[model samples]
Target: MDKKEILDTLKAAQVYLSRLKSLDNELESAVKQIINTFEETERNIHDTFSNLKVVLVNILNKRENFLLEQAKKAKTDGLAPLEECRNVISSKVVGTNKLITQGNSIINGSAKDGLAAFSKNASLLGSLPEVPELKEVPFISFHVDPTSDNEVKDILSQLGEVSRIAPIQITELCEKPGAILVEWHSVENDDRLTDIQEFRLQRAFGDVIKEKHLLVNFNDCYRGLDTQFLVKDLKVDQPYSFRVCCKFEGIQEWSPWSLPQVASTSLRPFSWKISDDFLLSNENKIAKPTVDSPKVLYSDGPQFCVGHSVEFTFLEIDSSNAMLGLIDQILPTSSSLTSTPGNSFLVDKSGKIFVDGIEKCTRLSEFSKGLKVCFTCDLVNDHKVRVNVDCNEKRVTYDWSIDPDYKMFFVSQFYSPNWKILVE
Candidate 1:
């Protein structure tokens, strides 16, 4: 009951209070994390279900409309002949009845009247139309199975249990020409599998009901951790939806598919057929026009259609003497490269835009590595040409009048291994 005893008791109380505070802080942190996880799970599930509902409804509606249209058309066609036959039969019956009535009147009339009636009956009989032959109209029958509802119910019952494995999180999706790269991460601290084994990537493109789904497996390539998979051989500029799932080495069941990621592949490179007017120098990397050769390399693809543009991506630009333009006439192989041909529109590397060997615009742009230059020929609008140069995140465009009678080509009179271009 002295001062030392009281101080000792207060110190013990303080230690207890500090421990309780630490426990409370830990509990709050755990609660917040759990709440966040639950919210994410709920959102994902709801979104998936909603999307599935919309897709199913759309499919069902389309099928219903198609079948209804078919049935309606069949009904209209089937009834047309039947209606015509009915009208013909009705007319014949009326004529026969008239003839019968006239014959009866003649039998019951006096001599003069009977003679008149007999003539009338004869006329009626002669004027009657011939009975047309009735051909059988084929009937359309649509069969409906009464047990289909039960069959669907049975199939639904056999879909098995909902997977307990956490869904994959898509981290990155890159679209390239003829290919797509999909990267994903599994749920952290997932204890469903002791060691990760394999992952399955599935993709659906075009009409879901018609297109065959694609499935690729990454077994040894992935060490059961977060990784990426490149899907190749895909059609360019086609939209595709993808999902991922995983399985343990010893487990039989695979995790449920991840949320769908939809993207379209990049446009395919232009089908460029290099002409022999230019020599392939520097290990066939650079196109150089010789002095005695035509300074033009034409593409075998179709001419620039209306609103269709051509883009060139420069991987390397070692020379600034390149010329891009359209030519109306194919110059002879012995033509000199010093003068631009007539009926041509050329853009040179020195920022000179020329039309028919005359300077049109001096606002030309230089090229660099990883730069894209696009030329759009607007033949519909008085044969105008629009040139767009994209470099270093900057773009510049120039508009110039052009001759519609010319074809386009790329001309360069230099040899450099670092001068490569891709036409898109």
Candidate 2:
């Protein structure tokens, strides 16, 4: 054959194959469409049959009711209303009664809600929460923490529908005028402050207040401070079971804390764990991060070029303990650094004495210094004496001439070390 004839034959074969592929795609699309239509038709048929079944059942029920009504009339009781005649036939005739029974059963079985939906004892299975009696109104008078209104609402809602819980009112017992005071009332139920812990409104140590001791003429063993007036938000006219004691003039002693006291009426709160790590932790920075913060440590301070981790020196507080903070190391004494020579007491220029190379404690003032820590001994001579230290590294700088000054008001003066001159 010629070259043109060979090329023409190849073109024909390629066109035939293209047409066959196109036909196959069309056939597949048509088959999928037919299948989808069939499924849709089947679903529609099922829905139509379900709806028809309901309609048929309603019609048959009406027919039965009407036929029974006619039969009731034939008995000649002469009921006037159609509904009344149906009810009579439904109750009286055996077959009609069966229909009536089944109809009632249908409603009972099909209907849902309230006591009707539940099996016998299902209502009993779930107990009605004990309704709290309002012996005392839900009062806002207590050591309230920083509680928001929304938090109070949440607590009240859980206890029961709060008929009424009043807002906070502040006042203080007369003696401690600066201290906080509040009062709240529950008009309807004892639901206020029931779950103070859950509401994030419980009090803590940092909350401070002044208290008054009022001894009323009323002699009650249960009440103390003669009257431990409300302080730190403690309630008044409220029975508190606490151990308390008091001391008077010459040789008086404090009383012991009394037993538990309860308000007139309160909900028995469910026991909860004492840990407040969740709510209070956010306010206090003590919630240490497991991962270091200020995330990107800067290169401003150069670390050692060779080591993988840094080695820092912390003052050794105990020979056994491995770790210490800067504050923990400073609080302890330098007792291990004291020195002593064999027992002759010598006095320093400041009228303090020295025995073995250490000092002897002669005066009350001298005892306040490190001289008391040294071994107790009498002066070697009938005379008082003095010694001096010129060494730069001694680190001993206490002067025994003046007493460590202090005030009676504070347990210890924070800024002065002299205040640490602990009483024996």
Show how many residue pairs clash in every candidate, following the order shown: 0, 30
The lDDT for every candidate, in the order shown, is 0.59, 0.29
Find the 10 residues in a row with the least total lDDT in model 2: 321-330
Clashing pairs in 1: none
lDDT of 2 by residue, 1-424 (tens): 8989989988988898899899999999778656755685578667776886798689879977977776665544432344464565554455444445555665687533433433332333333333334452232222335566578557545632211112211122222111221222212232332322110011222211111132121133332222323333233333322222223324232222121122211211111111222111211211111221111111112211110111111111111201100000111222111132122222222334343345544431222222222111112233322222222223122222211121000000111111111111
TM-score of each: 0.35, 0.17
Which parts of model 2 are misplaced by more than 4 Å?
A: 1-6, 76-424
Report RMSD for candidate 1: 22.7
List the RMSD of every prediction in angstroms: 22.7, 36.6
lDDT of 2 at 413: 10
Model 2, 240: alpha-carbon shift in Å?
A: 88
lDDT of 2 at 93: 56
